[model samples]
Target: MRAAICDDQPQALEELKKMLLRIPAVKKVHTYSDMNNFWATLKDGAYYDVVFMDIDWKQDETGIDFAGRLQEACPYTKIIYVTAYTLDYVEDVFLNHANLSGLLKKPVNQEQLERNLEKILREQSEAEGKLLIYYQGSHIAIPLQDILFLESRLHKSCIVLKKQEYLCNEKLETLKGQLDGRFLNCHKSYMVNMSYIREFRGREILLEENHVIPVSKARAKEAKERFFEYMSARM
Candidate 1:
């Protein structure tokens, strides 16, 4: 999808961009360090499928103002508010807009970026979340939003997640397609959803759900890229 990230923090913006590269499907990702550049791009009719805005930027216009203007300009493009400070009336602020995708708390992490990301992208994907898992004697439908990561162990595969793991015979490739870009291949044997990710240490990726998945020696770069793209869209 075509998307943009708008924030003032260079380090944070760079980190967000880095994570998004892991996904092979992202067509375009534009990063803006401040609102002026971003607003100019929008004024020039540059639209994105999604836009991530840092709510507390020092721009003359706040993210809320930009979002409202964006709603008037491009109603279809999803608006996601990114904030470092805790917001009390997030819903009220969103109500004035046309259609809001969702919000992200700042110092944005992978999982947080991904959680509501697929939620917004679900409609954008040609095929909305179609991940079908056969587990516990029934075909358990795993929404892209609920997934953590899929782990391959030896000849078999294990699904690691927050609530529970459903043993399945499905291959990662097939499931990955159903996922769209919300989940990515971080390791040869491991596929992860960016929404559940917390932090990516040298080899270990922490999940907000508290599970730790190892980034394989061969897949570390791809893993990092996945995180970057995901966070970039999050802003």
Candidate 2:
């Protein structure tokens, strides 16, 4: 796992970096005393699985504010707030929109850091499984969680994501076999990811970003049942 530490205090940043380096799962640890440098690196396409952020900063933009931007830029990257002002910012952190994983009060305890890392690692393991497909003469691995749905485009299959689509040289049935329980075949031509389902209304399933997929009469009952089952398991 690639990790990053964003704290204004040089000492605090170094301490956390040292602790993260000790963890066997963490392959790289990047420390930044300035949020600009961190954001610059992120804009340069640097990906970190988790970022330890300090709530307080000397600049006008607080860590929580920066984290919100980070969330928009990289929705999958987990954000863990490491702050000395935990009591003051705990409510704010929850209220703000971000991919929050865990919160740690500073001076960060090694045990607490490990606990957060363990949980994040477990989630990453579950989501890291990708669907390898041959597209445009290249084998591309798409993260399972990012896939919103699959559409049968005649002989070809369209892998739908939040903002992009990939046409794979395979049938929908063949792709369905590779997917896990989170996917529900709502229609003969459509397999919707239950995680992206916003609501199941009548003969249509509404997904995130207001995309709608049809639910065939034959598969309607089973699709609804599977959707509920998936939601219940997550709860």
Candidate 3:
């Protein structure tokens, strides 16, 4: 996860950065002493999953006000206010924003930081339902729902989406193990996300892209049953 720390005090900023770096899941950490620089970078398209903000900015604008503006630019970004002030002073503002992850008191201990971070990471993983794959020497994490199906071409796997295709080095079997129950192995060469399935024609499955994937004769009955079960639960 990518994170940013915005604190006027340099000691507080580095302390938070050091703590965040210890977490294995954290990919990058950026710090900003000035809110203007932070906003400028975000406006220019910098992305951070979680932002640790100090409530007291020493300026006219408060962190709560800046967080509201941050929401407009990055609605998906989660905000965690690290402040010395009691929650009573900011509880009302915190409750108003659904994107705000949590509030940490000053002199945050390892336990408090890890607990909040674990929550954010777990929520992030579950919300994204990402499937990590390597293609063309680049690592890609695609949302599971975005993928329609996987088609085996020779020894490689071609990931089929609505408008694009990604060639992956992993085989169908390897990819199948990584996916959750939302995906089904319809054929030896085809593994599809049941959520994208539009219609199951005994011998094939029709997806959102109008792409047809063959259904193996052996698994046809089982596939049909599972599809209906999934639809019923979804409805």
Candidate 4:
């Protein structure tokens, strides 16, 4: 996930950075201690999966006010008010924004943050909709429905169907956004289409077509669990 954080205190910003780094899914995070820079980026059509902002950020504009404008500028961005204030006061203001995800308290640790982060990303994935992938000098509409999973070679990621594969220039992360639902990343280089999976071995999955995808060391645990759950539900 690409994220932008707006907090006045440099220390607090750094703390949040450390916690975000622990989560494997949060790929890049940009820090903006100044509200002006935040506004400027929004005007330039900057896209971020999440925004962690201090509600009482000591700038000319309150974070809530800035969030209101954000609703129109980048509707896909999920805003989380990480202030030390009660959410009751600004409930309606944040709700006015297009995609306000949640409000988190300060002094957040890894566990507390992860629970909130999980819920928000789950919704974000569903709300942002399926992403677009272009291939063969033409734009092919690969709905989240048609995909069973995707695997990457050095230069290209192959979109796997039951009987066909489409080659594209997108990276794993780019394809992840385009692929909807629990198309979990079971390998650093392999993102599975949960629908096609039939069963799991120690580190591989049996697809409906008997295709085997090797789950990398990094993502093996999560991948196995995800594949197990998916198969169990079907059985």
Most accurate candidate by lDDT: 2
TM-score of 3: 0.57
lDDT per residue as tens, model 1, 1-235: 7778888888877777776655555578899986778878766547676888777767576778778877655545678777877466476566665467877786777777776667766765643564555565554556667778887665345777678886665445434445567777777777888887878888988887788878888888877887898899999
lDDT winner between candidates 2 and 4: 2
The Cα local distance difference test for each model comes to: 0.71, 0.85, 0.82, 0.73
**Weakest 10 consecutive residues, lDDT, candidate 1?**
169-178
lDDT of 2 by residue, 175-207 (tens): 664588788888889888899999989999999
User: Clash pairs of candidate 2?
Assistant: none
Per-residue C-alpha lDDT of model 4 across residues 26-87, encoded as one tens digit per residue: 99988989888987875544667788877786657777877877754554467887777655
Ranking by TM-score: 2, 3, 4, 1
Q: The CA-based lDDT of model 3 is what? A: 0.82
TM-score of each: 0.49, 0.58, 0.57, 0.53
RMSD of each: 17.1, 14.2, 12.7, 10.3
lDDT for residue 61 in candidate 2, whole number 0-100: 87
Model 4 ranges with Cα > 4 A deviation = 87-97, 124-235
Output the lDDT of residue 68, model 2: 88
lDDT of 2 at 227: 88
